[model samples]
Target: MSNSSTYTTRFPLLAKADTPAALRTVPGEHLGELAAEIRAFLVEKVCATGGHLGPNLGVVELTLALHRVFDSPRDTIIFDIGHQAYVHKLLTGRFRDFDGLRQQGGLSGYPSRTESVHDLVENSHASTALSYADGLAKARRLSSEADRDRAVVAVIGDGALTGGLAWEALNNLGAAPERPVIVVINDNGRSYAPTTGALAVHLSDLRRQADGARPESNVFIELGFAYLGPVDGHDVSAIEEALHRAQDLGRPVVVHTVTTKGKGYEPAERDEADCLHAVGAVNPATARSSIPAGQSWTSVFGSELATLAAERDDLVAITASMLRPTGLHPMQEKLPDRVFDVGIAEQHAVASAAGLAMGGFHPVVAIYATFLNRALDQVLMDVALHRLPVTFVLDRAGITGPDGPSHHGVWDPSMLSAVPGLRIAAPRDTVQLAEQLREAVAMNDGPTVLRLPKATAGPPIPSLARMDGLDILHRTRSGPLDVLLIPAGPLASAALEAAVLLEDQGLGVTVADPRWILPVNAALPAHAARHRLVVTIEDALRTGGMGTALAQACQDLAVPTPVITLGLPTAFVQQGPRAALLAEAGLDGPGIVAAVLAAHPDRRPPSAWSATTLATTPRGRDDHH
Candidate 1:
């Protein structure tokens, strides 16, 4: 039942056994000193492993104050996104294992109920803590026992405040006036980037007010909840006082604590947008370098989107507070009016895009493929039902390594394909992404989803321009085929290499990279029929994913190809390098070779394919055939 599979020994400073001595018995001045120590420890541990940095740094004081003031496990505290729970992890008996954070079989990236009693929730997605808190509060309220007096606190970021689900929870919590729900709003003025929309502006103006002079009845108050704060989040005494005040209110109350995203650290403090919201890796001396120079899918999308927006005036981009990551920063800068960052409101983002499409505008929603799950209802009902042509550029379309299971977009293709009138295209590289994006925008159809991996951009393949849909990448010389390879997207590159190794064993192999890959590729059945065995590979889950889809597709077509599908298992995957995860999942070049050669043991031919170079075009169009 564990989320991760990695384990590690404890660092002396990060040992949880020393927490009581570090703060509880120490002088009041020690809290600030301890906070500084904890921040440094977090920066060091997380920078090596790469995790939610700015968030943990920002919440150092808040987490310290919370742990000090309230008895956790008894007093339930739920972090909304849980991305900012590193501070909580450090204090509540997980300090030693923090270095193993997000690795396979190691400490989880987010708060996990299974990890510890202090960690109340295993949340990774945004804007659900309030609802969970409300439910917990209601459970306590309806308790028959007279002595159930534990408090329920939900810590949420301001970016999450813009989501409609949070508002829905607010309305419900507001209805029950006597329910004890403390909604702590950690307003740092950003969500991946500086938050957008009029509400953010209002919050900014309110924050600008001197301490006690701010308006009492704002949005949260309007919902019949007591509202407090605009308090300095870094002040341990002040934050503790605010939490005490919130608990004393005896009703659903929101405490607006304004903290800098990366407090104490000068570089993080000066960061304009997300403030190193989540760092990759950096040298201890200089916290800077990341994985070597390679164009990420986000960079390609950002650059291409800016150019696309420049050419088409009717086109408008919408993101659920992910401007920088989704590659909309350039568009946001150049066409500020056109780009709409609807805070962390994915549902609203989709519904609003539908409205734009209705008004004769070509609206493109650029969202993380995982986040897109939140807005599916809106996309289906508001956009698809209305036949509004809205282009959904799904970034991180498949296994997003290092972010863990919650952030992986493995099921996106399978989920979206189920929605009628939705056409999904899985691109192989940057050129295909650009062309497909253009095609998706130009077609005045209902809805189209473009699924691309994280940062698969490189030099375009020379034979890319003429590639067609569902074409075979490798062809045997009319020999009895031992294996037929089917790779979802760029995994085809890996399969190609595996095929070379398989050929050396005298096992005839054919590799196919279906550029316009969907769950239901008609060519797959006929293609599979030609081989003795068919193996499907994709960077997604095996259950109800691309592999399953391909299996079902082959079954439906009456193709009796004994298909051995490889994909992510029906378990939560941990965080790691892309190569590592791919190899572990048996989808990388070496892994694929191992699996293929294991399946068939016979002849040994010379290798045919070289190192795979994925083009953004269809495989059929490639002249290599």
Candidate 2:
């Protein structure tokens, strides 16, 4: 916790305007001072906690103005990509809690409903806020006349409008012009990197027009929206006035306010790469990350994919507004024409990749696993049904930390496994990532996916032997196989550690990595038959996931061995360290050992287990395996 006296002294105006009600009481003239204070506070605290610093820094005044103009809690406000709602959180009496932003049991990086009444949507995904607003407004109209008077504002920007859902919501909202829904386009002209595609060009034109003559008509006007702005988002007075006019209109309105992402911070403004969009714990003075650099799973895949692309003229890569973050920048830098940035349109990217594949090009659609959920239909029908040679390299495939539930990549394997011809690969380390990627692209018949976690790629874990497609990571030197442990992707390390602990208890154990996780490798069931018990560990949902599929495969093959699967439950996991979450979920070394002992047919009692082992057992069973 920060010193209260020091905090109050630094930002006197901010101290007074802790809540929206209190903010409304603040003198209008001192609002600029308050905004400045908020920016400084954000730079200090967010940089310290390592979160969406640039997005939050960009929206200080806009957030302040919205709270002051609209009666929040009564008049609901929804931030599109809720990372920009840090300012909203601050104004809603969360200023003191800023110290714990994105930490476990602390304030989330995005809007969390449990955190405050001011936050209507906990969405961190790009777009979808307008749809939420539209629903809320319709509900208000149906509920009561008093509710109808309440305004619904959807604050969307940073390339969120590029998403198809945002357009769908705009279409619905525009049709009902009488609905008092304020669509604030907080255009900073970026989503991680600069916003791409035709929409970005259109917004650029609008910005240019704003500097000169007022345009008579625009896209918003054509959609039946009362278009306002190209207003300066930093000017709280102008934004409040525009918002007030929008309120009086009693109709759907579009207020296009332009703001600088990473505003007031020189380092953020100067940063060409994501504008310091998201950062680790940083030196506040220089706005540089304090954490030491390391090669990540994303980097390994990116480097290898670029190398492969250079070798194969037919290979191309695509990203939906995250070229740099997804590690497509290497390929983009080397072969400019082959890499595509499709804005915040994952659906379009996947469909386009299918088209690319159909044209004799094997397209690699590199994207975050969570974002892939948006285009599952495309991956299934458009790609898999057609059997296109498109490799989806999913970065951040598992339990991603800090960004919270919405950002976790736990659903991809379960969902993608349902696609008939799609093959999924979970690389155990950097060596396997490169090797598996080659295998993924070489397959000419159907679609393939390579999923990896967000953590740094540790030293390579070499396979003892390759059986069929599975990598034998560990095996007892001389004993009957008591338990077979199958780990998905990076969990191979943890599985090996558990094997050693099990071996310490005089139990023979075998650990295997199913590099190709989906379709349950043909030889897996036969191997399961060799052991008395089989355990599968993954950083995905327990239901309908890798474990479930493997168990079903074993049952089909008449392998009588009992299969006990360990994975995250079907629930929204909160923001925290990935390591901590995995340990809590019983996916760690000690946790895995405990689960194995509990399930093993020849298991010894807990009292008989080593004291060192029992001391490390995870506390609760309700949330763990």
Candidate 3:
């Protein structure tokens, strides 16, 4: 039967079922019918909401087997890369809320803690599930409840295995055999793109081996865990049988299930790139993005970097298992020799980039802002300490709406704040992205970063003047500035509109983009000295972000320009529409106006910025770090 085909009749068992508990009452014979229903439901709902459709479609039978065989909440269950947890949510009585997924005050695209008691770990970052499972199992053993009958299950994908943390947890689990835990290796064979490294090849070989007596060929057995199938993951009965065998062992065991990445949907399965991993709202009849492929920051970087690579043979590009997502395809295609895909190992990518830099090659390390957290120490010690001319291109630098808190690229700046000789730039648009990228690659003295948000790349905001690499976008008066509106990256356009709002209210505003936001450019504090109030806005944490650095600079310059920082709040921002989330965090023009007015009650704020408006998204993740 085609996955896209609708059932002739309504679901018999699943239609009225509210939760996983209801599934317990379902007859064993009805399992196949329920699985079919769930698959169809996912295809319809996910397409409407725009989410991780492919991952969920791949896990329908596995999910059914999991819920049927194991008692969740009573028996702990955790999903790494929680985007595949939609089936879990629906089984846990969230079927009605499925249509509202990824919207404000609606269903989250990933596992949300407050959403239910069944979800223990709402982790989105890959490879942390094993470590989390180990810790929980150990805690259960160490405490007075040591004798309790409970099991901890971690469903981790093969793509996540490329990370070092998984091996670290494996080593620990192997050393102590007393802890009873189940590690379900969901081997779909892709992470944004095809998964790389030695383990993937090892697992691929293991998948072809027959079950039972294959212990001699198994690596999990060597790690002090019994190895169970190369099970048919799409077959609910087989998967359940495998789980039963794992439970019977009463010790750490690996239940390897080989499944398709995008099993049901024709479009997703046929997609060679990313398997439609994460997508926007698509037509249910035909999986196509409603949003246009406008030149995003990722695209701009890809094209420009590819151009740079063509000109220079010494330039090398590296990505962490995300070639297409991070926009390295152009380079990967044009100069395959220069491109390096280090799998999901961010730590290795950064360190290897450092090695590449030392080898007389200028390495451009392209990675997601959130994922960079894994490689902080590596980048600091290996790259920054040596002050190599390695350019770190952080693609999704701010609030990545649907993927939830774990996916947001907010903490990169605050984490890298102490790294000396490190420079950071936030480009306002496509033109600046190209210019800053070229400058970063050309600079051979120290490490640099070109950070941008995950949104459409718009027109450039023309600068009225340039001082010490900073672009002065707007200035109210020459004599004494009332407010110095220092906007970071994409927020420059919005700052311009905010200036108009303040100006209409008789408050002079000077909006400038410190192109290189880090190191507190020498000209910034001097410019602030002329202003009464220095207002800084970023899409990152205001505490240690660009605003924090600027405030410290003001203190050092002995300039008493009282600074007001505006950005995202200090918390785990929930999944919603990107624009709505920004508005909620007071990063929008109206919110900026309200904050400006609240800060300066005497000056007040105009009702509107003018006929012309600026749409700015901050480069920071939160208000304070």
TM-score of each: 0.89, 0.97, 0.93
Residue-wise C-alpha lDDT for candidate 1, range 1-625, written one tens digit per residue: 2222221222333343234335455556767767777777887888888888888889988887777777777888899899899888777777667668888778888888778888777888988999999888888888855424888889998888788888889889887877878888898888788766777887898798845576756877788889877888999889889889988888888888898888877667777866388877766456687557588878887888889999999999998888888888989899999998788988889999999999999998999998998888998899999888999998887778778778888777667767778777776667777877888898787888888788557665322223335656776666688888878766767877877867766678888776656646676778778777777777776656566666778777777776776777666666676777777676776666555544443522223322221211111111110
Q: Rank by lDDT, descending?
A: 2, 3, 1
Q: Of the pair 1 and 3, which is ahead by TM-score?
A: 3
- Point to the candidate with the largest TM-score: 2
Which candidate's lDDT is highest?
2
Better of 2 and 3 by TM-score: 2
Residue by residue across 1-625, what tens digits does model 3's lDDT show? 5321223235445555547788777877878778778877888888887889888888988988888889888888899878899989988978767768887678878788788988888788888999999998888888666434688899999999888898999988876778878999889888788888888898888877755355474678888988888999898889999999999988889999998987878888888987478778788778887667787889889999999999999999999999998999999999998999988889999999999999999999999999898999888899999989999999899887777778788888887777899999999988999999989999998899989799988887899888777888888764456788888899887788878877776788889899898988989889888877777888787678788888888887788777778777667777776777777666777667666665563653344532112332232222211
Worst 10 residues of 1 by lDDT: 616-625
lDDT of 3 at 475: 85
Q: How far does residue 361 in candidate 2 sit from its true spot (Å)?
A: 0.7
Q: The CA-based lDDT of model 3 is what?
A: 0.82
Candidate 2's TM-score reads 0.97
Expressed as tens digits, the lDDT of each residue in 5-38 for candidate 2 is 6778888888889898999998889888899999
Q: TM-score of the candidate numbered 1?
A: 0.89
Question: What TM-score quantifies how close candidate 3 is to the native fold?
Answer: 0.93
